[model samples]
Target: MDFNNSYRVDLREMNFLLWEQFDIEKNLLDPTVNAEYNKDFIQQLLFHARDFAYNELGPNYQRADREGCKLLDDGTVQLPSKYQGIWQKYTDAQWGRLSSPQHYDGLSSPYIVAQMIYEVFQGADPSFMVYSGFCAPAMYLIERFATAEVKQCFSHKLATNEWTACLCMTEPQAGSDVGAITTKAIPQDDGSYHIEGGKIFISAGMHELTDNIVYLLLARVEGARPGTTGLSCFVVPRYDLQHDGSLIDNHVRCVRLEDKMGIHGCATAQLSFGDNGPCKAFLLGDRENIGLRQLSSMMHMARISTGIYALGLAGRAYMSAAEYAENRVQGTSFKEAFNPRAKKVSIMAHIDVRRMLLEMKSKVEGCRALIHKLTFHQSWLTNLQALETLHPEKSEQYQALSKHHESLVHLLTPIVKAYTSDQAWRVAELAIQVYGGHGYIKDHPVEQIARDVKILSIWEGTSFIQSADLMKDKLAMGRNSKLLVVYQDQVKTSIARNRKAGVLLVETDALELSLAIFVKTHALMGTWVKEQKLELIFSISTRFLEMMAEVTLSWLLLDGAVIAVQKLKNLEDSQDEAFYTGKIASAQFYVNNILPGVKSKAEIIAKEDTSALDATGDMFLQRTDLYGKQYF
Candidate 1:
């Protein structure tokens, strides 16, 4: 299991996304923000993050995965020795707190700035990120929702990475169906609850990297109502702090570990709480049965993080495929078959290879753009809230702006999470196809990337799950719900503005064309919602997500291409030329080849096929030979 430093970071693309596309400097300069952020800050951080990824994490990835994690007989999980040290080094660097608020001893760089670091580290080694990535968000929840005393106990340590945490949600019976969890919490006199239950597929649940593991466990309290409404969240730790300040065991047990397909370095454990007696847990704030509501925002953050993981691994796969195609010369050109003197060329020169590479590039970069775009919306919404807090006289103005950003973030979150993860697997598959047979073995990096990315679509939520959310919430057009319409208008405005972008004309047109289809399907979905056609809504929900994600990604890519077209004309350096050139190629290729699927998906949805709904039970009951012979 050899690892290669094949990860490529296009600083130019990062700059383009930050400066040209989003104008992030302008965002920071908003009167609400009161912060100084220039291109130099972004440029410096990009280089630093690149160095950190290549030198610190990339080298350890394969060794860690090969070594994997081990569960001792005593119910302790130990990461690979090398992987364990990297966590300490990572903690020392304080990179985990990059996106945390400053009051907790954090840098609190803007979301997009932090996202650059995420892409690098995840691409360099996603398993390593699996260990460190959730820390900030976990600390964020604690800081926001915990009691002052609980904050005193856990905030700094979790924020500084002196402590680690895991999210405990999935049970043996309940994976995505959070409402079905049976974890029980009994109340005690000391302001703690006795937790008793088992949770499966808890990543980083029982690791030795920290002094204690803080499990953000969801459990139902005694005599609560049923379903998610009855479920409350608890901050359950591996060990409890005694009155004398000495730590005592909390009776948290690692029941077993999942032998997973990839990301072997991160342990996914089955945890049992309070099998012998009681596991102490502090309620997350004073809330009861509002755990689902509280966790929803954090869950969205995790989903976005999952998509970032997909983008990073997909980018790495693309880089590996591109590098291999450049070096691995095999067959002679079919065009020069008659000429005996004709020499073999790099596979990168092959048209089909270019097509695959460009498709992967377009999807990865487009997904990155979409994720950052969502982050930008979230950041602006935060800023507007701050403005509302500071300037009461301008509350209405700030509220309006905040609503706009909120709508964009709400509408785009599912698209980023589901679309990016699904495309990542496709890109990994294409990367393998680009490498031919050599890609299937562990000798290359793409194979592991393929394995790792497969879990992402299933990790945050399944594709169908995300799609239903989109259809049910984002596109739901009631009295206060107008995101679908607003999003369509925004895309139309962009298309209108970019009509003059020379080489991007076709791409912009494609976006415009696809967006029209999206609007049509959106209207159809609204009809289903109005008509109370529940089955129709559920059936075409994923298709609706596809239409939404493809068109939105196409718009983002074409918007980047519009900037690239102007930059290309003014750039003196060939490197700048090449960078802008690639951006243009990615935009053109995606809109021409990929985004057209949005229209087709819309057409399919319009047909309102109910075959799956009408299928007989016996259709899937058994299988027979083609000759009508049954094995049984």
Candidate 2:
């Protein structure tokens, strides 16, 4: 698997994202973070992540995938033997607890570093990474909301990787529609509740690597109301543990394992609770009807991880295509006029191939920067209290700053998860095209990467869900007047920078038009809400998401250009020169080729396109009898 080389690329991207692009070190050194850790210590932590990814974990990724876990009829699941050693290595190294609290034998490293480690793991093999990655979020939720007793009993084990966790949310009928979940929890005399329900698509639901599996099950209490508001979250363990921490057989059962398209190594099990009897479960928080709100915290983390997955895939695809183009010889160059006996050159010399490669690099890096920046903001938000203790005088100022940062993070989350996944598919396809015939076969990694990245767009939340959230929650964060002022201020800053750089003049103009259209569209959306135009809002939500995505990405590219110019002036090394050059070229490519499309989409949103409203079931029915199956 060449773990060292693979993670070297991942680490390079991570470093570029954190220290170079976002200057996370500076943020960490702020009075808030300086009270807890120093810059050198943080750097050492990042180094540890690099070592773990390359030396320990990356080697077993492909082997684990090819030799997936097996489910036994006796209701036991066994992972590949190779993963057992790798999992142990990761746990012993405390890699699983990178984001956990320091009191629980965790490093409590910054989120940027954690995200960097996740990127390395995802690039190595996303399936194998789930064993620990899935547990981190569960542990995070417990740390944030669980009682002291519960934390005392489980936090150490989870942080030490003695137990793994799974988020049990989806049911057979309630995939993406959480309100329809029918899982029930009945209160018992012992203060604990008895949970009886079924959960499907539970990743790492039943695996042999841990002593016990902690299931963060979402269910409805008996006599509770319907919909997501009445739902509550329960902590259900696979095996009952005595007060002495000894295991006892429990009633939780694995009904079946799903045959998935990719990530075959991670067990996606269908779990049935209490078929034999009621299963003991403890509610997380004292408050009721807070299940969805509690779950939202983990949801954001999951979305971030999903974005990381897309970024990793995009990077892998770019490396594959770049390597192929530099080696694969094709047609003669256009500058062959100087030589009568011109020879074939590398495909990179061809215009179309170079164009495709540049486009992939541009989007990959742009999306990487966006995701990493969001992660940095989240880490800062999480650790702000710790920061406040160090600088109490400026605590109020920092709190105000954190509020704006939180809003920015919320606004960017959907875009990071949705747009990156959607664009990653295109990047993967281009990588395959660059390889020509070899790409379609298993000889190259592009086909697998393409298949793997497809899950990102559909998981966490679908692109539709994200787009709707952007239009509804993100835009409606405050009064239209306040949001407009903030947005206009941002636009003005970009315009100022653009006017100085003398590049992206056309893009700058296009951005202005896009923002104007967005304002009008937003006004229309408010009116629709007043008129109760739910269907119309639903119809235009997807297009609205696209418009926001384009504008945000364009702004990010322009920001990159501003930095690239500074680097170009002081560029010292060949590598830095090439990197900066690529940055400028990518930003230009995006502006020239991509940003123009947003105008047309904005027009559609402004006009309220409802073409789908007129479609009939018969249009999709079996027209083979009348027009043949090959009608297309």
Predicted model with the maximum TM-score? 1
In order of appearance, the predictions have TM-scores of: 0.96, 0.92
lDDT of 1 by residue, 1-632 (tens): 44655666666777778888988776554634545445676688788888888888888777777888888988888787787778878887778888776778877677777877788889988987877677777888988798998888888877777788789999988888999999999999978899998999998888878888888989999999999899999999899977787788999998887898999888989999999767999999997889988788788889889988988898889988988999999767879878888899888888899889998899989998999889888878767777788999999998888888888888888888899999999999999999999999887888888988899999878999998888777767322357877887889888888985556676676787788777877777777767877788788887778878888888888888888888888888877887888988898888888888887888787888889889988777767999998754
In terms of lDDT, the poorest run of 10 residues in model 1 is 28-37
Off by over 4 Å in 2: 1-13, 31-48, 334-341, 391-395, 477-488, 498-507, 622-632
Write model 2 residue lDDT over 187-296, tens digit each, in one string: 98877889988999888888888889999989999988999999999889898778886887668999888887777778889999999976888889776667999999
Clashing residue pairs in candidate 1 (N, C-alpha, C atoms within 3 angstroms) = none
- The C-alpha RMSD of each candidate to the native structure, in angstroms, is 2.1, 3.1
